[model samples]
Target: MRSRLFDAAGVACVLALLYLERHLAPVPILVIGTAMALCLLLRRAYPVPVAAAVYGLAVVQVAVRPAVRMVDVCVLIAMYSVVKYHRRLLWGIVAGGGAAAGVLIAALVEWRSDTGSFWTVFSVVGAVTATVWASAYSVRTRRLYIASLEEERDQLARLMAADERAAIARELHDVIAHSLSVMIVQADGAAYVVQTSPAEARQALDTIAATGRAALTDMRRVLAVLRGPSAVVEERRRPRLADLAESGLALRIEGSAGELGAAEELTVFRIVQESMTNTLRHAGAGASLLVRLERSDGTLAITATDDGPGSVAGAEGHGLIGMRERVAMHGGTFAAGPVDGGGWQVRATIPVSG
Candidate 1:
């Protein structure tokens, strides 16, 4: 409220200057001076309003006292303020042109009665026009600078997000691949003990326990991604399909799983592990699982199909969705659905660079 009061007080001072000058017969010097001051002060908050008022006052001064030299400065100062603060061409155009036209017409009318010289008229008009053009140029330059900064800021933000996602993806793959492989190995060993080795099945349970502990450690790192990355999680190394086949996932390698980057390798291994786990869970007593890896062109394709208890909710579950995201991180294509004859099929084609 106090700030507004001061602004009003300042406006009143401008009016007071005009009134005093009118009585003293000192021309429009005080009037134009005060107009310039108001334009400078109010440009940011009230660009259009201030520009309108300044140009209007110039017109009024030209009408009342045709020989006034003070109006030029007010128009010039106001035009600059509008350009710098408002950063708009329209306001600058209106204010600048208004000042030049009003002064030129006034000088033409007051030619014989006042100084009656081309130099005086041209000088005043030239000053107003030049000031307005300079203001417009300044506004254009400032707007360009602002746009450039915003573009750069957006680019930096995207790069940071990509780096963080890469880190998080690595952590997820490590945890999931390690845990599921250990579980399959344990489940397979337990199967052999159902007859005379019941005590050995108890040992398999301990392996599951160890795998679960490792999973929990990785889960902490995965959850940290959601909280925002303050520190980089260390990369994890896990057994590949070839290394893990002994765990009884029945890993059948048709081609190379590739010595690609860690992130890509992790994605392929997780897809295989996830598909296999789903098979073991839903494929009844005698479900046959087939894991195939083939290299086609510059891509490695992994296809896991199971003659399970028919499809195993392939498309409607989180397993499928997670697999797709893992594949997509490397700009790959992932597809999973029911095969033609009552089975589940999950396929992923990830890029490789030799």
Candidate 2:
């Protein structure tokens, strides 16, 4: 509603100027105003072309019969509208606007029959040129600032998306890593007991059932996070290297646990777990996983390998991407590939600031 009122005012000013130019009282002015108003209707959609047409018409008028009356009030307004809305070639628009104003003002003053002095002409040119340039400069600065703000907002949105993906990856690790480890341990225990002790094998079966249910519950909780707030998402605990090595995973360490910060230790632990989990998933049930953590000088080297069917290729998923991101976060070198003869091997050389 307010925009319509502004356009109506512009139309009224244009009609008043046209009336004075023709000395046609009000009738001819109303006709020209209505015609120009049609251009205004589509100005937003085609600002540059509409403004160009208006300026072109004025240039023709100045060439034929230059007068104070034909100085073009509507043309200046249209040019300003083009710069404000069109948002292209700002430097060119400013230069064009300044040039047009200067030319029109000089022509009007020079051609006026009852003109005064050259100083009067210069004064008008200087004043009008200064005012138009100032207005154009202000518009250009505001547009540049708005563009910078929008770019900053886009960057912030990307950071938020990355954080959400990281949290989800952590949740998936907690669910799959512990489940695979416990299952492998139980299966090995049952196999050893099957020939020697049948009762012990039955006990291993019970452990397998319990581990499976726990894994299912972990998955359920993870999926629940996606639903509405009516559902609860429990806090999931992730399996680190220390937990597996201490537990029945039979992880072997080559060197002592060097003096390390909790954060660095956690990073090492996660790297080892992710490696072992990958082995269990792809390397088959009887895969032999060997873990080695060695610290020397100022670096920690953590490596894990499994002698199993992982000698062949399966698929690479989000797990590899997440592992790379985690290792890169703390400035570490990571390598994971197929061994020459058999199995899968992963190694990380991480810097430790003791």
Candidate 3:
């Protein structure tokens, strides 16, 4: 709506100026001025064609009448549209040709009259043409810069989303793998003693039921995080070191757990979960495992050691790789190797800033 009003105003101003200077001007001049004013209405839609028409009319006007009138302002407006809307190469060629034609016509009129300075006319027309084109080019460059910045922002958002999905995949793997290992162990024990030791077999069945329930709870929590922003899952479901005691593992927490960020806390939990799962799978039955979490001097440290046979080598398995990646993402150090006393150990230290 604002643009339509401005175009109407421009046409009115040009027509009024032409009439004020009409005195003894030819009918052709009035018709040409009106045609050029109408062309301004289509400047934004068809800038090149409108600019060509304006320049052609300008040449005719200069040839017929040597005196300048306010209608000439239309030439600047047309040229500004050409540069602002059209590509630079095409606008450059068209503008250059039109400027040359305008200058030539003006020079001819001044020479024929033999009363005005040719350089003064040339300089004035050249400066106005240069000023309008420069202004339009500046605006075009700024718009292009803003478009590039928007494109870059969109690309960054996509990368962050991909990273989030990968993290969720790792968490799901840790939860399922650990729960299934414990269930499988208990099921095997129950099958072997079902007839010979009824009481023991019944105890194994109870353990299996408890492990299944815990697995379902943890699975739901992980899935909730994947349901996007609308999900109302608890913000933090961190597992404490004392939780390991129920699984027949020694628990030791040093200093304080302190206040860790969400990502850091999740990373710590997954590392410990994966470590325990490996111990349950490869360590011998009745093995002793020690789980520890400590915070000191702006760093949080985690260690899991098992007193089982040193059979679980630190290979590039998916579980180990996921644990390493999680720790590295938080700028932490991670290591896993066989301990001196014939056992496997996994340790990591993550920096935590308040």
The lDDT of each candidate is: 0.67, 0.65, 0.77
Error of 2 at 43 (Å): 3.2
Clashing pairs in 2: none
Q: Candidate 2 residues 35-128, lDDT tens each?
A: 5545665565676777766665555544545444433555556656666666676733654565567455555557465564456765775566
Write the residue-wise lDDT of candidate 1 on 1-354 in tens digits: 675666566556655655655654444556555665566467557867886777777666666666555334556656655665665567666666665676576567657566666668768667756866685677668788999999999999999989777667655755575478568767787887857788778777766776677577657757765765463244233436654453444445566765777677777877877777677667654565687888768898888898875656445556666788778888999888778877788889999877
Q: Which candidate's lDDT is highest? A: 3
**What is candidate 3's lDDT per residue for 174-194, written digit by digit as tens?**
878888877887788899899
Error of 2 at 255 (Å): 14
Query: Which clashing pairs does model 1 show?
Result: none
TM-score of 2: 0.58
The candidate maximizing TM-score is 3
TM-score of each: 0.64, 0.58, 0.80
Model 2 ranges off by over 4 Å = 1-26, 33-38, 56-71, 90-106, 115-126, 152-156, 159-178, 188-198, 214-269, 275-354
Stretches of candidate 3 above 4 Å error?
Answer: 1-28, 60-69, 88-90, 110-116, 193-226, 232-259, 311-314
Q: How close is candidate 1 to the true structure, as a TM-score?
A: 0.64
Tell me how many residue pairs clash in candidate 3: 0
